[model samples]
Target: MDGSKVALVLATSAGGVGRHVRSVADGLRERGAKVVVLGPASADELFGFTESGARFVPVEIADRPHPLGDVRAVARIRRLTRDADVVHAHGLRAGGLAALARLRTAPAPLRLGPAAPPLVVTLHNASIAGGLTGAAYATLERVVARGAAEVLAVSPDLEERMRALGARSVGLALVPAPATPPSPDLAPSHEPESSQDARPSQGTAAPSRAAAVPPEDHAAAKRIRAELGAGDAPLILTVARLADQKGLPTLLDAAAGWARLDPPALVVIAGDGPLEAGLRDRIAEENLPVRLLGHRTDVPALLAAADVAVLPSIWEGQPLIVQEVLRAGRPLVATRVGGVPVMVGDAALLVPPGDAGELERAVRRVLEDRALADRLASAAVERASRLPTEDDAVDQLLSVYDRVMRTVF
Candidate 1:
């Protein structure tokens, strides 16, 4: 977009959404597009949108809906996006607020007033709530569907839902991969069945790094293992914020089952959030073999140090951790939910979202079966090579903006 003015709106983002918006701002600014990011002041403080070279404006669009707050946010968004060529909103609540501002009325109460600058909304995650909360979110989905000129979805399920809700145009949004680190080395396994071949096979796209692990990574992995008090036992790693959506209870349940294994696996969860205290209580109460390593910055080392990685999210939208795991070339066992199956293909063993037994089985296979682990690790590297880049995301985003502009103008 040569000098096109684009306003990016999002809610109070703390994790992937915040990083993604910042990445978009950086990419758009580098391409000479005038980008303005509007979100909570805390998000700017966390993600540094202004540091990414985009003009940062604070408009409090919250994760949860509030009557007075929504009104204030709608007014702020409407005023800020008035001069832009296009307005792109991320997440459900932020998109709904932007849509209300752009349409000038609740479409159910009255007809759409005007689509002045053309609105585009990106649906990043699916609703996991039920009953009244789910219904409220569904209503917002319809509002966004009816208001946006075009909608971009992060997963197939999200795209299908938007289309069914009557979105004008719906397409898959490409989440760019996280920065790649040096591929991890296979951990020494004490299990009789494990310790088989764990290297890339003959392939054109296979990672060209040597069989030897990077020295610094090796040292870091050793340090992390010792610090965690994991001696000869294998390390089972999960890198997720301790939240309901992450299905931590199921992970703990699986950990309970694995606790009986001789030289039982040490489960390490390396992120923190609202559910930290609850998860900590469950671990102590059940005496589960799981440790919470709250809000870590050394994920690459954690991946390198682990025997196998697991993700048991109830729903996810192209999670950056999965991409990072693939780049690390670690064997993964993730739930077959949302974008995960498409992301991992045959690179990971897929289990149902809440099935602790199946999850335990899949993870155990990677621990006990050496050949499977090697194949998954090799396949992960091949998959990593094909994931979308930041340039690809910007090119696709510009295409959407261009098309929407042409239609609106």
Candidate 2:
């Protein structure tokens, strides 16, 4: 395929979706394609698009749907895509905007001649509740599906959901697990330290070279364990957003009874969201053995220090955290929802969603039964090996772009 100019659009600039878009943009750029990113203005500060060598165009798109915002977003996106060969939008809101921009309406005539650039949308979530808000989102989903040149789902379950939601051409592109570097490679390089020491100090405080250097996994893990008061005790780590869909409340309910075990477990939840205050309240009232470390950047270290990783989500579309757990080869206890079972297979102990008792039992078994834990960890390593890499995902995505562009042009 020729080097095409692609516009990668996203509504929000935080979380896994933002990271995925950045990786895709970087990958496309590496392959000689000109990548332009369009998202909320916050994206510039959040992801550092300029540092990554990608041109960023800040668009005013709200996280939630608004009539005026939608109109403005569509207009901005249309102008941005005029010179783009492909427009790839991430999430429902961005997809809807891209779709609206591409639609051949009387009021909004095609500015880029008869054919607009192919719009490829990646649907990240498959679960939505049934209500008026859900109904409105469903309408937008259908519009996005119909307007998009191709729809990509992150998991098999989500692929099916997209098809049912009116997406004609749907493809599955599993989100790759985080690649683990070698132990020696995980160590911080001394080059930055030497440079910092040699450089003359200015009157103003210089930026910390510590932030530039990667932390040693072993040291970081020990530090995290100490902070959590997990002294030789089993560390059950969960890295997820504190959202309703994550079923964090159910996990807390389960944790309340964990003190009954022979040697009580220590739970470290490393994420922040809207439900943080409520979770803190519930933990205080119940006196559960759980620590909420809001939005941690040391997930790899936490995983290394964990005895078991748990994900008690009500719904998921092949969660990246679950994949990270498996990739880290940590024994997993995740709820059997969406594409989680498909992801873990026999490598994780799957419990029913919202079943706090079952979640509790699963965690206890993984902690107590040494042989079972070992078996799961061993299986996890093998399963993770079989999973696709980010490079592979990028190749599959570029293939879709080529296929769509061929048809469109």
Candidate 3:
């Protein structure tokens, strides 16, 4: 792979995809592969691929569907892939653009040879949007599937979706969590001191983000917890982008029911999105005991400060936050969606998606039953042991690249 050139294309650099791309690029570089990244300009600011030793090229790729932007992105991708040995695209939009670019830039029929590069697309989400938007996305998925030489899904559920979308060569590759170590200062106090020692070491816990938290940031978390009146109260933490896909509405409804209990639990949601205004309105109208912290960087501290972590997403592809929570040794309550069940296994209390009553009951059970929460936490540490580290994920991905190159060229 020393002389091989791999181009990674991404649509948005704002969420988990951006992080994943950065990790892959770093891994490829470590393996002596030339790597180039093409994505929205914001990706540089968000993930800093250039600073991390990848050739970063900005392109006009929007997160949502746009005919004009897609055309521009595809044209740019074609130019970038001129010297690339492998064009690996992440997410649906980027995959579509890369596929179209490959088609437009293919060598003439008479000149076509085994040296032609392969296009590998990794589908991060299997969810289809509702109404007309869903139909449009479905159409794009079909185009991407038909064009890509290989389609990789982050979860088994998404692998099935890829196959259904006409992908002839489909594979599964679970997204790996970052390897930032948990902050020692932010470690939760409820777990026995021997908890970490009790678990068998599997070396699967991903390295966390930089462990050094500013003193002020730690203070801020403490102040926020205090403001929420979380004194001896079971604190529930949810870190997700506020969107329809996140199932915030359902979580709010469950919160409302939980609020009516004799001693309501305090909930803190740490992330912002387009649904912020509407979610705030609903929170005020319902008077739920939930706080929204927009886009936090100190999630490790927050996890250490919370009693339980919950993910109520309607759909997901191996959510990183879920893995983070488990790595922090916190009990989890997540909906059975996408690869969540596979990620959590028996470590979390799984509930049906969009079920407010069941969600509320699960949260309540965790809060009231100390023994149950302890059991889940213990299981969480062990479950986290099974997760692949960033290095492992990179190794698997490079193997895929090799396989695709072999099959195509």
Candidate 4:
């Protein structure tokens, strides 16, 4: 590699970051820089970087307060950063890993002629932390900020949040999320039997938002109705982590109020996390028609089959799933948060975050008024088209890599 040429040390502790890291790394590679991903096992399991032409190095992440794990993470990062012209961390885990890396001692790698790569952190979410633990996280973030050479915030919401949390010394840049609206096609190439392909095919276009809707997905909806023995049932889908912020409990409470006349209305909550057992129990106890799907890649098809897509999150960081929902051209009923307003634009029926009654009314209105659903879906499609495309997001990522490399050399 040329001494001036750059390298990226991408890291993440979640599935979403894999998409962003791979997109950025792929873009950087296309722009002629060597890129390496210091991602987690989950990220690797979800998105295989090796097959995508980038080197994948495993880096275990410590979820704050784990001093020993932090030390190990830093040591691992130091080894990965060796010989790299620029070390750019992708998300929060990558940020912490990069900060830890700076603490590790190393004789400069022989490959570097003069310039040493500066450490960088990219903040993807606006919330630093929540509740009592936030103070500790804030202090740690400030410490990390002081060690970093630059801090990139994906959204203005994130930038403001960081500023509020007291991130001063690090050079800050608002990188505006570079995600594009999904493809318009309504079918995914992978079959129902092959859903375990898990990782996406390398170099494939980012999954189209519209592809979330497949004929089979609609059939699944029909199947659910058949199982419930309620033919011609109206369906509402919520694809999100079942947590407080995602507002699942509130959604279920609201589901209790829906009065189905001729055909019963059903609310399907897909994707799973900490709140699964509680949510299942709540459904059983309350006798709500809401069904819980632990987790399914069949989401796109489910979204397509549904009457409406609801994201009642108290907060969000430019949810890719929302983009997928929009690409499916489904009417949206979402809580206004983070870059959600930016995603939904005027297409979605927005409600105050955490207001179950309002959420209920929004869904009911869409269900009762087919014209409104059609209008919302059409508007969603138009708004989705206006947002940046995956190609555009890739270009912006390349620009970031190029700009960071310039700072190093």
Candidate 5:
């Protein structure tokens, strides 16, 4: 009811994190709460946090661990959040550092005396690394679990991990995708079942029809298919970064099997990252029927052009692209990991993560049966209709803040 200041902190964010922070910042300011976003200057440049009416303070929170730089970052975080009623940090790196700052720094000349403001941390991803890197991240997880007043996870697995690590308050984070704009041609066909009920069926195809698309979209799809060298071949599209976490290797392995199919299916990947060079080399050496498109902007058109949409990620936490695929009303074949099953419901073909055979078979199943593909496309549109919006994310976050303040402050 009274004036209270909140500090939202994060590390490097090229995509989802930045957009989410900006959206949350806008929502908080609209509710009359004083909001300040503290992160890298580059993140501000990319995401435009200040444009959302929140004061943007440039704090260098690097992606990896560095001794001297981390000290400097902690000092900055301490100085910036000294007057804050609550501090909320996103991602493991930022959360660990925020926890360290509050633990080390003395109480400042602000609202609370002798004790720093309560800290809240949100975990958006899981530890997919191994050996030294995995251990380091695990250490950070424990630091966050013990230091934070409240912790939020974007998936069930993350939530369970945080609780096991002894976090006082661990709840699911509300990281919702924006609802897709409705099409006049599409209507509510049937309610999709939960992930438990949804399974990739090998049964005979059910009678179904493709979703209605505009002539222009179909034309654009045709153009893209031509560009990807899918003359008369069935086009299979995957939109992901060329990184290990994205499971690009598995995708290539699956593509190897597709070469034997009649007319030979074409695999087109649209994204760029560090693993590009090696991936290209392997593709050339193996003569796989796959093309690396390297980050295309016309994703909707690509989705339209495709026989099927695919995501072969090793792990993900409510990926925006999967939601985008659903919005486009495309039949998806994705790995079952993180929040993917929860997101897709019965809308898409979900397979085990990093299983190339399963991934290949799923794509094959979709391509072989036009009726089953149409059913998935119909369920996708239905799923897109039920996804939460930016407003829902803000409302959920506000409740978390309120509870943490009342319980800890």
Candidate 6:
């Protein structure tokens, strides 16, 4: 109830945690909370939290499990938590570290501080994707449940998964990452040029379907189309990594069949992975008009530049690009996975994951129906308007801090 600032402590190996952490940190700052972020060296550099005018503490809890690195990270976090008003861990490593730091040496014979910060863990995703580290995954979940005062989930699926993983009495919250609207609405600049040249070779190999569109990327599409000599045709994009879980193979086959039709639809995939060489080889063998664009930073610009945004992930925990593309107010054709349906709502055309036929038809439908495109764009614009503003998110976070602080005082 009194006036006091809280500190936000976030950790992540990589990926979306950075996004969530940044949003939280910015929110906290807006609410007058001092934030301290801990993460891998790469994250510290890439995210540039310090440049964003927040304090950043480096914690090298690598994406992969390493016994020594994990132990060291926990110790570093323990030190940081001493002065924290609230310790909220964003991902598994940070959560486990917070949990371990708060572990009782024996049955708690006594209480410690008059105002110990409440420890909260936001379950970002199921670490079942951890493979052989499956046991480690279970252990991490247990530690977070035991150590943290609350568990916050980003989606309903993850919240249910948290319960199944032994998180009892969870404070279920469907806190999807906030989306920012485009700066200066970029309408279609010119009559979209014929995209025939941007089409990839039917026989070209593709990377994983989990590949992502490049950031600030728009020029490459025109370049690819010009190279392929098919710039007049309609171009569709799917942004994700080329991993098996992303359903790249199914999309590729669908593109092959779609190519045999009139008006010639082209699919461009932007991302990188171990599947790159294999995907390219498969494209060559099967002859599909799919192009692979390695990791791009200009994704927002590309979202503005493209005719449509497509997401085809087999399994996902709320992909950020889908939210971003929607915020750009573009029509989207996405597989029904993760929080995509939640983000797109009625704004996007949905297709089943890994269904090439469905994906192909959806893309074709988007191309043929100008009225449908306008409708989706209007709906997307409306949906984007409903997303949590940074100020609102900050206010909610401050409320969480007050709630957490009340327990301590």
lDDT (Cα atoms) of all candidates against the true structure: 0.83, 0.78, 0.78, 0.64, 0.80, 0.66
Ranking of models by lDDT: 1, 5, 3, 2, 6, 4
Q: How far is candidate 2 from the true structure (C-alpha RMSD, Å)?
A: 8.9
The digit string of per-residue lDDT tens for model 1 on 201-268 reads 21321222222234345555667887998876678999998888998889999998777665678999
lDDT of 4 by residue, 266-307 (tens): 788888787899989988987898888677766655665577
Q: What local lDDT score does residue 358 receive in model 5, on the 0 to 100 scale?
A: 98
* TM-score of model 3 (CA atoms): 0.88
List where candidate 1 sits over 4 angstroms from the true fold. Answer: 107-115, 180-216
What lDDT tens digits, residue by residue, belong to model 6 across residues 75-169? 77767777776787777767776667654431341243444567777766655365668778777777776666677776667677667766544
TM-score for all predictions? 0.91, 0.87, 0.88, 0.79, 0.88, 0.80
Candidate 6 Cα lDDT to native: 0.66
The residue pairs in collision within model 5 are 271-295
Regions of candidate 4 where Cα sits further than 4 Å from its true position: 1-14, 103-116, 128-132, 164-230, 259-262
* Candidate 4 similarity to native, TM-score: 0.79
* Per-residue lDDT of candidate 5, residues 1-409 (tens digit): 1367889999987677777788788888887789999999999999888765679999998877777888898888988998898899999999988988886542331233345778999898887889987888898898888888899988889988999988898988877654445432233324533322222222333112235243435445545766766766777889887877899999999999888777688899989988999999999999999889988767777777777889999899888888888878888999889989999999999999889999999998887887788889989999988888888888887887888778753
> Which candidate has the top score in TM-score?
1
Candidate 2 has what TM-score? 0.87
Residue 266 CA error for candidate 6 (Å)? 1.7
What's the lDDT for candidate 2? 0.78
Q: Report residue 373 deviation for candidate 2 (angstroms).
A: 0.3
Sliding window of 10 residues with minimal summed lDDT for model 5: 198-207
Evaluation by lDDT, superior candidate among 2 and 4: 2
